[model samples]
Target: MVAHEADYEYVIHKFETEYYTYDPEDDSEVKPGPNTPDINPKDVKKLPSSFIPEVKNECAQIFYRFKCPGSGLFHCILTGLVFDMTREAELLYKIIQWDESVLQPAGKMAAGPLFDIKCCEDAVRQLHFPHCVKTQEALLSDGLLSVAHFTDDAMSFIKPLKITDTHVIVDNPHLSAFGLVLDFLMGIWNKQVKGQVLLFLSPPNHAKQTQNINVLLLPRNIPMTEVSKHHQPSHFILVPSACNLIKNTTYTVHCPVANKIQPKRAEFDMEFGPNYSPTFVIRLPMNTDEVTLTIRDQTDTEVWEHEADLTDHLPFSADGRIPAEKIMVMLLDILEDLNDEEFKKFKWHLKTEVWNNISPIKENYLSKADRNDTVDLMVQTYEITGAVQVMENILKTICRNDLVKKLSTLRH
Candidate 1:
């Protein structure tokens, strides 16, 4: 007799905090405040239990748990999703990748990440998902933006109860995979929206005398913090520019100095997601220090252009001993172990000039600087080798012997 067997994959997430911090207002402006009529103040006896879920897959699939004490508004830091809980319950939710082509028949395209939420039926009174719309001048007023709910092998669109600057609020009668979509049939394809162009350069292959550069075309609403967290190894080139892009329009990147460029053309798709793939890639000679990048539309008209210098953004030391990204990763890992107070002490011990250069934007670096920001500042101010030495001395001085040992071991 033959035996039948099946295999299942499971992802587990653990949280240490009893209740996550609930700020009344955040810089992102993605969450609705208590005074918002959507949330009743009386239901919020305590802040709703929140967690930042860990990514489980390369596609950035995340799994988390929301343990509600009674009933209140819960916000997700990653996907900008908010839940209004009606009763005490534990909810398991995740952001999953979907085949966007399914929406073609509906004459719509995705504008945000798709979320799969599971909990007791009717436990959630409403769900608010962040949208990429830059303004409500025409899209919202014309009723082109809506939520796509997938259930029982079928998809349906839901009109939002309220549309704000950051989020689209919808009533949650049934829990399933939901995402934000725009109906192109409603003349959305002809309209241009605010966009951004980001550049990332890979470490040069000295042996082959070649390098690769990635160009990303994204909506202006996507947070830089999220993009930086996902792309750690590549050196991000800061060539800021205002861009206006049309959805589904073909765009071509031209670089005269590049050795090779792939695809020749790429369609501009609005992707607000857990995964951000490069729009175009250009290959150049290792010694080519500067290049002129131009993005032209299908009509052969230049839409965005920039000249970026490759010297400062290169991720290597003068002697090519260690890559800056490696040192950055090591420093980030070490700093993660330090508490807020310890981190403050470490910063206080730094040289005056170094501190000033690290945080030129703010007077109080400790309050605004995060682990990535600190590591980036250290690497930028001091090269790879100097950054390593400074971090080692600070770790030792802070009495974080464990982190110091780890740093030394990793450095060698």
Candidate 2:
């Protein structure tokens, strides 16, 4: 373990021979390996008590010729165990009430491949245990053998995390379609553990300035966590943000941890490999923020954009005081009609709701010809109206946040 910590990049040196791999990543089972350790029914007693039960139960006889990818530099021990219904229920209870703040201390033993037993009392006797001072007592006692599977996600001298449910994001360099990782993550989530799937990073080459992450719920027993578009709420976890003001930008998150007014917060930039799983804090403006937007504009509707001075943008002030009354006023400005010609240079919307809600048409002011002609004109110009609607739909796209893209899609 110490060696792996220092250089995890170390090549697995052990030779693989005659073993099978039931890979969790893909549903596919790998072909068995060659030149590997042989542990079968006959060799079970010869196995050391000091060894993990997985080494005893799931060796060559079951896995026969299992292979690890890469060169002969990695050495991994994948073990499986069998447990009764009693252990399964007990283990489930402990995991739910798990304290997020501290590491859980379970005896460093893992159980695998559960089953029903002839008797709960006899089942407890056969369960494997870790080395401990009171281990003999713990074994003889109820709790240790009571639980079937012990998840020791990884203990550390420092704070450690033991995780079970995982969603992997492979950093595929050559793949073009970006939603593939989310598609893959969608594969693992289910109702058994209604876990929070937070994707920490993004696919490379894809540039979306605002982090586009979607979380979803897996319907009961349905393994896939579909992109919950209609019912699910995808909120932007706000951070104190400012544009182009070049210092190492920082913000005070109203941290509720450790009640001392301000708890020291930490930051994590994305690294290699998978990005989907239950996580504490997710990184913002992920690498996928790297997209190029080609603006598409309508012939009738003009658009404009301004890099508003951050000093003036409301909610956040030059002198940071977010006033109570300012919320509605600020939101109204978002709906305000800015028909300035400069605004035409950017992007535009029909503002239909605002137009309709503000007032009903004043029919009395209209002549008979004018009244009938207005409706007639709209009907005659259905093609123009369709073009405008198409333009409005295009601007509604998320990529419109990018000025360049906001311009291109709005263009012919």
Candidate 3:
């Protein structure tokens, strides 16, 4: 036993020394590319609605549409953005990734996702962008927040008309790429703000002995719904507490047993964006059951630390079981075929007591659940129970034999 233990320890020490040591060859700077063109309106199928916008997810990109009968307020169920419309028109919008290097000269940083908005008529009068700052009142009073409006040739910042606890209000004279920004000139660069540390374990590979764990340090207000839209295949680690992070401050991640850690350190920018790239990537042995993750500022003061369990987050599917994300995509493809009434019946079937013993879709959730919401709940159910068969049975009960067959094929 002692010989075996010594051998394991020596292997771990060698692995750490060889891979964790800083290597000059591994250092490479990645430059952000130019922003891609906005999606053509003709390609998107518009869903007409008077109140709630019809939301769709295509290839991890979310699109929203709303039909305005007259002047009223319209809220996006996915993104918290609100639109004030005047006269009848059709509104279409989607969150698009943009190169934020342009904001550096102005000493401004993105505080929310950049939305590419298109309207059939010049009817929108006001726009509201959701912000996650807990001390929004103080920030609003200090005038630290502003809106970034990007046109074809130029980018401009607009002062907000009003600030609420949840949203920043601005006048929408025209439609283009609009997002929220915070100015460092207002003394917000060093301010400690609400922040989140998101952890995602990559899908396990049986042939490889090491796996990558991606970490994202972002503003707390950036919606998880938006993040999940991009990272469906990875296993999300739910952190229990929120951390306070200083904007523009450099932070370092430390894991004593990690085989390798990339980038060495990352700056915690106020980038709440359409693309959520991982801040750090830590590679560890596949057999590592637990690890202590620590985040420290440039000053070497520890900001956040957690001991994460690897068992539930392994994301290995060696047992012939389909991944939860793949199941979610398949379910979404099947659900898209259902019309309004048929979708209603599907929700009703999900709410039945028979499913309660397994993983019940909540009554309140089903009351107004949309297609995306339903798929999310089903995925959660699968994760909790590990019972893909239950979902197939439910589909069979609802006379969705076509969907049931698809689910069966996915399971095998």
Candidate 4:
């Protein structure tokens, strides 16, 4: 065993098949140290017969020694006994912990697929490590049983997650859709561990500018030290559903490590692939913020009904003032009481008195019963507020008190 020093930098190397990937980012031959011996496959050896019992009993402290070409330093990792070897080289084998400011020395070991070691920080910052003593090796070894199926087989031996309790509170309809699946996953996870797993899923809300799944997993009864040795809270983007535009449509839940392991923060993606799980689809309308939404299926049956915004497509001010064209619709409804000659006389008075501008309403549109043309002209020529003021003046001149009241109520 070597003592760790604060001034020394530690480097971890991945062991590749061709050659131990001394430096994955670099691919050059490493020169040997002054007293270092040659490394060859023929010269590789195993642990002594005396240590066989320790290895078998899972009491052996295993260390992987390799040359680091990047910093020209020898690296030694204290990989705990009973590690998965199939994908060992790809794992982030360096284990350390933050002691407020600097990363304190923790045993270097490989956590299997079921386990993870991460740095937990509210904001992204570079992890600072205390100096440690560096150790190197000259020779290589073999005969360590490269077992790979340890974690997966162990987890598979237990029963999967299930929902048995009926007292679970499910208030949100969208969450209710995912109740069974969450119960299943939570059950399976809770069985392996002592704590209860809570998955909080917040779907995208266009009005709120939430365009992705914001899922958070909180482990009840689990210690912070245990959690710090595993995953950190992160934004897990999921595959969005194909019917995304339609409101209340349940999108399938797709996340990283969906099959191998449970994710602390998982994204429910909508992309199509082998990893796709057709999860629950909520029952609601496509446009959530609208005042009313009606969807009729091919059978003429209503599939969805929700409130929709009536003025969403209208050309009106943000404060609800209707444009001249919309005002014309209301005016026509009121003026239907006038006879054709009387309507003509009213238009002549409007053009000559109220609206004395060079560009006036055409005679034919006003003389005829259809005032669409005159309304369209007014919309283009005047602001809704100005047009309504002129309309109030015109109504007063004609002694149309009833029409004035109607316009007042319908103007906005």
Clashing pairs in 1: none
- lDDT by residue (269-299, candidate 1, tens digit) is 8887666778898999997778999999999
Error of 3 at 345 (Å): 28
Candidate 4 similarity to native, TM-score? 0.21
Ranking by TM-score: 1, 3, 4, 2
Task: Give the range where candidate 2 is weakest over 10 consecutive residues by summed lDDT.
Answer: 9-18
Candidates in order have lDDT scores of 0.63, 0.20, 0.63, 0.26
Cα error, residue 44 of model 2, in Å, equals 2.6
Worst 10 residues of 4 by lDDT: 46-55
Cα-based RMSD of candidate 3: 17.7
Off by over 4 Å in 4: 1-326, 354-359, 362-369
- Candidate 4 residue 135 Cα shift, in angstroms, is 84
Better of 2 and 4 by lDDT: 4
- TM-scores of the candidates are 0.56, 0.17, 0.56, 0.21
Residue 362: error of model 2 in Å? 88
